[model samples]
Target: MKVQRHKCMNERCSYDQQERIPFATGSCSYTHRLARYVIDLLKAMGLKDVSGLMDVSWDTIKDIHVRYLERHYSPPSLEGVDCIGIDEFAVKKGHVYKTIVVDLRTGRILYVGNGKGADSLDGFWKMVRKKGVKIKYVATGCMERTGCK
Candidate 1:
């Protein structure tokens, strides 16, 4: 498929139409229907498997999911959050660790940080305060692992 390129008419402006053509799904080769189909398939299949089945690049599948998530969750709202649980999980056996903060009431992840320490929880604390989510209890990980008293 050949897309006609458009050049800027004004002397000051130098914008050209080299970007991807905006399809019915916004700006992708696959249509909105196909994007949804791919997302549906993703629920049961891995990205690589989906890519193989769809005969598209793995990155394209990932891009489709990412765009969909961004569109749906444009701005995160912390409206009725009261209690949140924070814990550290190992990404790889015991070498790598990360912190995850989940809302106890709604079971939604509020924050995830790289290191498993007080610094990791800093962002969650600041965000909850800014959002005015009046948190009551914060259940953290065990003292045996994180040493929290």
Candidate 2:
């Protein structure tokens, strides 16, 4: 049986090959980076056994995922908005918390920030201001504990 290779995952870049190519920095082609993300996500979701899961190396998976995150999630600049809604939630099981801000009119969560504080809310406001988005009214839940308003 012949093995199948995947294409590169660098967003609209596709160059697949049966043999690996080394770049000037001694790195494999972009296709390998894409393969690594799939491998890493699978491993993270408890598919690391590799026999039934297709014999992928852990190091490869980790490298790809890290690269993917660095490329994809590097926070973008927010601009031109109106009416933001703020809400907080406990994302993880134990102690982790996060705040999600959304545009009320458009109903899109503009950004997620750390902590459930006025500072976090302030950060979100700053982002909007930086983007030249006007803030009309903020729809938010009660700040019972920290005296946030």
Query: Who wins the TM-score comparison?
Result: 1
Query: How would you encode candidate 1's per-residue C-alpha lDDT over 1-149 as one tens digit per residue?
Result: 77677799999998876445555453467777788899999999999999999899999999988998899876556788777788888887889879887888889887887887877667767787788788777788554443334
Q: What is the alpha-carbon lDDT of model 2 when measured against the actual structure?
A: 0.63
- Write candidate 2's Cα lDDT for 69-109 as tens digits: 78767765455565767788886773877888787777777
The candidate scoring highest on lDDT is 1
For all predicted structures, in order, the TM-scores are 0.55, 0.49
Clashing pairs in 2: 79-131
lDDT of 1: 0.79
Question: Which segments of candidate 2 are over 4 A away from where they belong?
Answer: 1-60, 70-77, 90-97, 143-149
